[model samples]
Target: MTQHTDVVVVGGGQSGLAAGYHLRRQGLDFVILDAEAAQGGSWQHMWDSLHLFSPAEHSSLPGRLMPAQAGETYPDAGHVVDYLTDYEKRYDLPVQHGTRVDAVRRNGERLLVEADSGTWRARAVISATGTWTRPFFPAVPGRGLFTGRHLHTVNYRSPADFADQHVIVVGGGNSGAQIAADLALDGNVNVTWVAQRPPRFLPNDIDGRALFDVATSRRRALDAGHTDTGGVASLGDIVAVPPVRAARDAGHLHAKPMFAQLSADGVRWDDGSQSDAEAIVWCTGFRPALAHLSPLNLRRARGHILTDGTRALGEPRLHLLGYGDWTGPASATLIGVGRPARDAAHEIAGSL
Candidate 1:
């Protein structure tokens, strides 16, 4: 028999957990379905030594403080996973792990969610699956010719993984610069960073706020349609952290021209420069994974869901958390996702 619920939350990450908690608080029948076997999604796949750039104080979820050791600057991926697991246990949230939803369709007034196990009928659906579901790899000519091992930054963890190997880190984002710096410190790997444009660097603390504010502001501006004037972008969209800048200044992070193509031996740049490396780390970025919900005809641009606050256009019963800006002050962070979840849950409750 198919189970019926008031709401079905797709993706049981931090956002989904928070959504479930809020839904329960509102006394609504909801269930969280996750693709992974466990609660944490991307955190489970992250490298061992990975620590959140945001401090623990900024990483805490709603009603729960993220645990941290004394004098620890930031919490690692393990800490995040532990916290999320604890949060689930604390809230007694209903989560179905290892259950992947293959497709979702609207049947008159209710929605039907079909998975490998069975089907779920719900009055509402929340797509909390984050943007990192899809990795963005540019299609450069001759990319297949590279003989060396090439992987995206999502799969990267520590420099020890590439000990004594010549590594080429592509992109100028924080992830690329940090990975390159870590590898360069090993003193065995020859690290080169390929930057399409020189990064704008900011201090670790900006105006008593974390440097993430700059990026957050830019994201908000972009979403608000305020930064597209004159075909010239603002600094917030292009700047890197001060530590990244210091690394570049210290010669640990060497900037190469934009990536043009991949050859059998190494990568070729737009400036006719080439670097023969043992491995390539592409730190380009990620996009939302919405391939499973083709029946909704959801509004989107550049593959990003377009919604006004918590309400998804044409599908009010469908809500999306962590899609774009307005997730809160720390929207993309674990702490930030909770607010949207709560807000969306409240909105869903009011409708019911």
Candidate 2:
């Protein structure tokens, strides 16, 4: 017999945990299906030395505040993982680990979630399976023939492996700059940063706190029925954190436009110039991990499912959470996802 639940929370990441907290309060019989065998979500896969843009005080979920060493301003990836692991145990959220959902289909008025482990028939389904597993790369000509070693941010570790080598760092986002800085620290590595546009670093004072405030205002404006221009775009760019600042001082923060094409040994510029690269590190970014939802016919162009708030358009019984701001205001951040989680769970409960 197939297991049944009042609600099925997909992904078991920060967003899923948040939703689980609220669902438990609503007395809803819910299960958080996690693809990983263990907790910590995708933070476990981020490159080493990665740090949050905001301080611990500002980066928190709904109930428990994220803890950090007293003087530590930004928490690293391991710190985040520890906190998330603790959060799950603290809330006692019913999470079924190692159960990867293959697809979610409509079963009459309910939703059928078929996973590797079992199938769940749920009154409502919340998809919080974020983008970590889906790293993106550009379609550069001859990219397939590039013989040099290459890696996206998803698999990147320390820069120690690229010592004394000519490496091209792709993407102007924070990851791109940080990796360039890491590889250039000894001044022995030839690190070239590339992106379609130059990296924009927010002022030092404008850390996570300021970003959160702006997002909150945008949320409030939308709640009052106003169009938010999504000024949050800049927030996703590089921040002038210590490492990035050090990189700027070292003259390593500069970026080149995306190369015209990838050569067997390096890249060719549109101007017929060439740079020798022994390896390439891509920080291009990620797409939503929505392959499991493909069978539902809800996916729209640009790797997203259209939604009015957290509810998938025309699918009132299905809610998509934590994919990005499009799914909820500031939904990608630890501090921002709570509101949507709470609201989504409440709505699901009331409908049932």
Q: Model 1 reaches what TM-score against the true structure? A: 0.89
Off by over 4 Å in 2: 186-188, 223-230, 234-236
The 0-to-1 C-alpha lDDT of every candidate, in the order given, reads 0.75, 0.88
Question: Which ranges in model 1 have alpha carbons more than 4 Å from their true place?
Answer: 207-246, 326-330
Estimate, for each residue in 35-102, the C-alpha lDDT of model 1 and write its tens digit.
Answer: 88987777988866556766677787788887774666677788888888999999998889999899
**lDDT of candidate 2 over 1-352, digit per residue (tens):** 5999899999998999999999998999999999998888999888787889888978998999998745568999888899999999999989989999999999897899999998999999999999999999888899998999989988788877777889999998878988888787757788898999877887777777788778778878878999875765746587777888888887877898889999998999999998988999989999999999887889888789889889998678899999888888789889989999999988998899
> Weakest 10 consecutive residues, lDDT, candidate 1?
230-239
Superposed Cα deviation of residue 76, candidate 1 (Å): 1.0
TM-score for all predictions?
0.89, 0.96
Candidate number with greatest TM-score: 2
